[model samples]
Target: MTQPSDVLYYSHNLNPRVAVAVARHLRAPLRYVRADPMGREREAFRPINPNTRVPILVEPSLTLWETDAIAMRLAARFDPDFWPPARREEVMLWVSWSAHHFTSAGGVLYFEHIIVPRYLDRAPDHAATAAAEADFRTFAAILDEALAGRRWLVGDAPTYADFRVASALPFAEAARLPLEPFAHIRRWHAQLEEFDAWREPFAGLD
Candidate 1:
């Protein structure tokens, strides 16, 4: 099969690690378009995605703004291990849950600890962090219980669901995401790090 070379991946303000992992799994080369959250770059991206979010996938035939949707589309075409037909519903459930709950909470800590200090040159918001911490723990506990003896999120093998959920965990320590109580999640994330794609999701960004 011919890999798509004209694919442009826009990511800057928000993390695109999951998209990077999917690209790696597909062995597709992505032309990255970095958007600056604080500059005119975000405005420029509005036409592409009215939500003005990064990690937007643009190709000749399609434009995908949501990360889970992009993962599903790419996996449907390129990688079966990530998106088997029989497991499609389960995969979507986890992906949706990650976006609605997990990532929302994790984004708070990531923005406070990393994005604010590193990019925005500002102090972390204590009130926001406190609220996010509570939310993080609530979701983390649910995930940890689900992962009690399971190594993967959906099936025996690692799938898009695993990638979607674990995407935010790379910043766990740096973001102080209140993960110390979730051993199962930590173990699962460690297993994900064993994959080359997961380990270096942001490889060429420098």
Candidate 2:
């Protein structure tokens, strides 16, 4: 008999950037719960996560939020090989890099420059946009250097770092950020698109 392990996902919009990380990391089918524009302001969603964010994981008795936490928990429970080295040190590196560094600087720049202005009708000036693009380019260059002669971030095989970093790239592309400048990063992003799961959420988003 199949055990019932539920994963309810809530996001501001269907294909949220961070939520995709959880989806890819978990390799689990998501049950999408439509998020209110003020979804984070709702107490209803707070029961699952006081912060009230999307990609929240409800696994039987436990509910987890925050992208890396959900990804780490899922990888630990369901995918040991997906997380190479399988050591606490390596796992921490991936999660911390994603949450603090990649998600912090890169994610912030993507939002402030592109997603916010385009989707939410917010005002962002040209200088801010340029700075954001420059930030993304900086991170991309760092990643390109890191991946030289290596296929993945932590090791040869793809790990949580790959998914987390890859998740951010699509937004950059959507923002019209040039990829021609970084061949390795472009190739890495292409590799991630080959997965069926990666294409699933993006199917009808266009």
Candidate 3:
């Protein structure tokens, strides 16, 4: 089957991680446009997305920003199993929680620990790291309890919700996300790593 090649992904940093996973899972051909958020590339991309952030999905019909929305749109179009109607609400719940809560906590550590040092050539803010660690633990506990006996996030199988939530985990080790205490999260994330999309999300990109 020839998948559509209309999806154009724009990302400066690794913000398009979940979108990449969704596209790969759908067997879709995504055109990646790398743009620096703080450079001239941002100015060039302003007409595309005024937010000037990465992970924007541009299709012939619509321009989608926000990782959760992009994941849902791709799932709806290409993979029904990942976005079954009966479990739509449950899947959305996890997606929303992940974007608003999980990533909120984890993104801080990732930015301070990995992004700042790598991109800006600066040291991590210890106070920010400490606060982020505390926030991460609070949210990680909730996630651990949810995954007590489940293999995936929303249903019996992996869905867009799983990909959305686990997106930041690839940098967990490097960012020091403090996942040691959440055995279930660790186990679940380990399972996510088995997927080619999660393992090498940027495989074909420059």
Candidate 4:
């Protein structure tokens, strides 16, 4: 059987940006395809990802959805350092927390403040934004406490989990994320922002 080319279908959304940043960090020999699964190509992209999400990684005999899963595959294939064996479970701990708490809360704020007002051409839902801000502070406190002395989420260096947790930090300002009180998370995210890949993952995309 012939091996299929690794193609990453991505959008500029929070999750897809993480995938692009990972691929860029790894310098993986893969083709990048910009896709708008939720917008103009919703119907056309359904067959590729039934849930209609981007950051879909299509490799030989496999079509992967979910941002973390895509990041896991990319790390497992190109660089083990990003997903170290001994620290795998520890990394997963943070990834799970992000999906369940931090990122989830942050996504709501982004959607309500940024997405609703800008793309949807409607006023943001203030009630939802206020509720999300409360949740953001609640979860962010946990993250802030966790990062009190650590540079990264799991290991000595940045891991996939770090990217996963920091997924929404880049948009904190634009989304009006309630991050001002979380000094530790702000400090940690500042370090991630130093990286070109994290700062501008789509710098060269056409």
Candidate lDDT values, in order: 0.79, 0.63, 0.81, 0.89
lDDT of 2 by residue, 82-158 (tens): 66545657756766765655545556656666667767876765676676667667766777787777777776666
Task: Enumerate clash totals for all models, in the order shown.
Answer: 0, 0, 0, 0
Local accuracy of candidate 4 as per-residue lDDT tens digits, 1-206? 65339899998888899999998988887788998888799998899899988889998788899888988888988999998988999989989999989899999998887778778867888898888888889999989999997888887899998899999999988999988888999899999988898999999884
Per-residue lDDT of 67-139 in model 1, one digit per residue for the tens? Answer: 7778887887777778889989998889889888988899899889988998775789999999988988999
lDDT of residue 83 for candidate 4: 89
| lDDT for model 2 | 0.63
Which residue runs of candidate 3 sit more than 4 Å off their true CA positions?
Answer: 1-5, 12-14
Q: Which stretches of candidate 4 lie over 4 Å from their true place?
A: 1-4
Model 1 quality (TM-score): 0.87
lDDT of 3 by residue, 1-206 (tens): 76555755555344677777777878776677665644677787788778877778888878888777777777888888888789999888887887788877898998998889887867899999998899889999999999997899877889988887886788898889999999999999989889897788778776
lDDT for model 3 comes to 0.81
Worst window of 10 by summed lDDT in candidate 2: 12-21
Reference-based TM-score, model 4:
0.93
**Comparing 3 and 4 by TM-score, which wins?**
4
Q: Between prediction 1 and prediction 4, which has the larger TM-score?
A: 4
lDDT of 4: 0.89
* Clashes by residue pair, model 1: none
Best candidate (score: lDDT): 4
Query: Which regions of candidate 2 fall more than 4 Å away from where they truly are?
Result: 1-5, 12-26, 118-121, 202-206
Better structure of 1 and 4 per lDDT: 4
